[model samples]
Target: MQNRFRANARFGGQRAIVALMLREMSTTYGRSPGGYIWAILSPVAAIAFLSLAFSAFFHTPPIGNSFAMFYATGMVPFLMFNDIQNKVSQSLMYSKQLLAYPKVTFLDALIARFLLNFMTQLLVAYIIFGGTMLFFEGTLSIDILTVLDGLLLAAQLGLGIGTLNCFIYLRFPVWQQMWSVLSRPLFLVSCTMIMFDGIPEPFRDWLWWNPLVHVVGLVREGFYDGYDGYYISSKYVMLVAMVCFALGLLFLRRHHRDLFER
Candidate 1:
């Protein structure tokens, strides 16, 4: 009987998550003119612009022969991190009204947004990366496993950080703007275009601690055969993500009521 009840609960949760995802798709994208196409185009357009703008400045991209490949590898992982983090962090605020019902909980909101956005970003990455490689006739060897690993790492980190930030943002609204401002520099410094080894000494030592740098390095390692991302430590990235996720759960469990009231 207990097992049956547990199975039913799990089924119900899956149904709720699917419902939330479909609602989000309809409201967030369906209402928009282009709908799902926008998801594909947004990243494609960004990479195109980055590749074109940087082609002159970088005769040789940090990774492969094609400027598009280099930027896509870097940008896609970074975008995955950025998008998932932002979406998860805002899940509470976005679904506050729905949370009033007994059927929905904060976890449901987080899971819904996390699953939807992660899959969307993953699809976008595959399309943009695969298309760029075919179009440019990229000579570099693409390590599919490493690319997936990098993206998975980015998603995990994003979920952890965003979960923590969700509670923080709820308790203190101003922190949202503050975090936005603070994260602005991340785009420039996250090795979106530049290689980790390319950075001069001393700085590389400090920048190595930033997880996104390692994530970008992993993506680049997958894209380019000769390039080595020996500096990346998956353990370190996993550690940071787990710690943040645990802390977020701790705080949220304790203070969720206050957040809901606010």
Candidate 2:
């Protein structure tokens, strides 16, 4: 009887997640004109502009022959992290109405949002990276497994940070704004388009700790065959992600009801 009950609960959770994903698709994208296409175009346009604008200043990209490929390697992972983290951070508030249903718990809301956004970002990365390789002078060879590893790390880090931020953003509304202002520089310092080793001194040491930095480095290492991102510590990235995820669940389990009551 206990096993049957557990299986039913698991089945119900899957149904809840599917319902939430469909609702998000309709409301978030369906309402908007050119809905899903916008998801691909927005990132593509950004990469194109960045590639063109930076190419003029520097004779060549920091890594690959094509500016597009180099930036894509860096930007794709960063965008994956950025988009997933932001979406997951708002998951609870997003599915608040649905959560009133007994079968749909906060975990369902969190997982639904995370899964949708993570998959969307992966698709975007695929289009951007694949299209770049076809049209541009990208590296001849690629390491698919290495790229997958980096992308997975980015996804994990995003989910972890997003989970933690969800609780904090609800508990202290001002933190959302503060985090926005503070995180703006992440794009600049995360080594999205720059070579990490070339960076000098105390600044490099500080950036070493930013998990996103490690993610970007791992991704670039995947794209460029000869380049070794020796500084990247996958274990460190996983540790940070696991720690944040654990703390977030602990805090939310204790205090999530407080938010619902408000």
Best by TM-score: 2
- In order, candidate lDDTs are 0.88, 0.90
All-Cα superposition RMSD per candidate: 1.3, 1.0
Worst lDDT window (10 residues) for model 1?
Answer: 56-65
Give the candidate number with the greatest lDDT: 2
lDDT string for model 1 (164-219, tens) is 99989988899999999999999888888788888998999999889999898898
Q: On a 0 to 1 TM-score scale, where does candidate 1 land against the true structure? A: 0.96
Once fitted onto the true fold, the runs of candidate 2 whose alpha carbons sit more than 4 angstroms away are: none
lDDT of 2: 0.90
Q: Residue 64 deviation, candidate 2, in Å?
A: 1.7
> Which portions of model 1 miss their true places by more than 4 Å?
none
Task: Write candidate 2's Cα lDDT for 142-173 as tens digits.
Answer: 88888999999999999999999999998998
TM-scores, one per candidate: 0.96, 0.97
Error of 1 at 4 (Å): 3.0
